[model samples]
Target: MAGRGLHHVTLISSDAERSCRFYACFLGMRLVKRTVSHEDPGTFHLCFGDEAGRPGTLFTLFPWQRVPRGRRGACEAWQTSFRIPSGSLDWWSRRLSEADVPHRLDQTAFGENCLTFEDPDGAMLALVEANPFTQPAVWNSSEVPAAHALQGLHDLVLKVREADPLSELFREVLGFTEIGRNGKLVRLATHDGAGGTITLDETGRLARGQLGAGSIHHVAIRARDAADQDALVQALHDRYGIVTTEPKDRIYYRSVNFRSTCGLLLEIATDGPGVDVDESFEALGMGLKLPSSLEERRGELELLLPSLPIPTCNRHVFEEIT
Candidate 1:
């Protein structure tokens, strides 16, 4: 039950380096760490969050180039969001337009005004104004000024063909409760102090989303530590009769993952031994890191991955700060 808050969202990409740059430069986020994915060491795994690489502020990138592109359907989470300041929506519009990024012409939906855009890999990204709703970021990045930087991931929409077993698991197993519903969408949030919204749709038909180019691979939640993550894993198994692996070290954190009854893969990751434990933020994200078992193969892993640069953003917020 240490599922404190939304720790991070992991997504699939064709090129980790490209995603690393786009998120850093455009969003004012810093690439805090780079490592070959422990599960699939052949691919690059990158994490971008605030300067300290805090838990709730993370956006992770995985390059699984060989996989086919996934289709966006009712069952698939098509878009993940970020909140900019209420009045800064105009500035974001101009910025995306100038970059030649295709954004859904500004629109109002779900009580917020947002300019939706796609990343180089095609993940549906949105820059929305935190209007009518106003508990702003306690801390924000320089790239997106305090006034315009992304607040954080608000909610995720899941397009499900059916919501029976999925809804029950979310309640009985995952500790989420029904907050609200609109038409065919059911919104569920956890009581664990994080703001994650899962929308189950019955009529929002969508094809199987391809997992390549730009798509979310899995949604990961934070566990206080190995013990907490274990408890969650056990609770899941006991509640639903689903078995999961013992905790596995992910270098930065320990994790236990399982695909839910709804077919959505969810992971519970420990919050300790962060990406900064071994390196300073000044020295962050510069090299490929390997686990102790794979330390001997570091050279091989490095050779397979792309040569990467330290991710930094050059947004002109300093001009405003002056």
Candidate 2:
């Protein structure tokens, strides 16, 4: 069976508020959920995405204040990219400049215009004008206008020591089609458009990556339902002798995680019981949310975790544009 598409990308952040300002205020994404990490209760887990916090649009972050900076090398996701409307690069370029975010414009081998930049914590990011202009979900409170708002994740760039094994796994197991290659970069994507693309770079000589702040933890692929996820888990074990962890309840979605042959962590997530399950659509991200398991400890946990400031967009900055 073919994969649905990407679900979300999770990253580690050094400061919660700084990351929020960059993603919510500068990039025009909405902070859809505020909660604590299930694995580490002390760290904050912030979920950002389109207005509804859809699976393909989700970008989740775990803020660990004291973590060291991460170095990008082999066996790591090097860059995370978002989809932008065609012909909006110039507007984005000026906006990034006004926000004091350093960025450079470049084109991929496939001829898509890209604006590459780094987050405050040094995580590599990009905006690619891949698809035609389509109106994305508009957050009424966003500093950016609806016409130029970000669509969703465009693609991810992974650097690894060996590409052939992972490449085979993506095609044979994940149902990705090899679309194109430019030298060492090989592009693959599912037939589904949103968050479906991936670029693999074979860099055998680079050192293994160190996980810390400003590093991507894992990228999740979408499973249409529970049965779809089971098939993917079974295929991994039966065909390649790869073992995956049993599905873990993530509150929003159930996930099964495994390491690819190239040592990159990947997850298959069921696309139900979404972010709005715990909170109403209109009140999302306004209050701290805890899973049932943590509900009893909510009072204590809130006092232990550092409070994050609510992000507000600078209206004057956006008003200056156009």
lDDT of 1 by residue, 155-191 (tens): 6666677876777877765667877766776777764
Which digits, one per residue and each the tens of the lDDT, describe model 2 over residues 146-166? 767888888888998878788
Candidate 2 Cα lDDT to native: 0.84
List of clashing residue pairs for candidate 2: none
- Model 1 lDDT, full chain set: 0.69
CA lDDT, candidate 1, residue 53: 72
Clashes per candidate, residues 3 or more apart or on different chains: 11, 0
Q: Which ten contiguous residues of candidate 1 have the minimum total lDDT?
A: 313-322
Which candidate comes out best when scored by lDDT?
2
Segments in model 1 whose C-alpha atoms lie over 4 Å from true places? 1-3, 66-68, 105-109, 131-143, 191-195, 204-207, 312-322
Q: Model 2, residue 169: displacement in angstroms? A: 0.7
Against the true structure, what is each candidate's TM-score?
0.85, 0.94
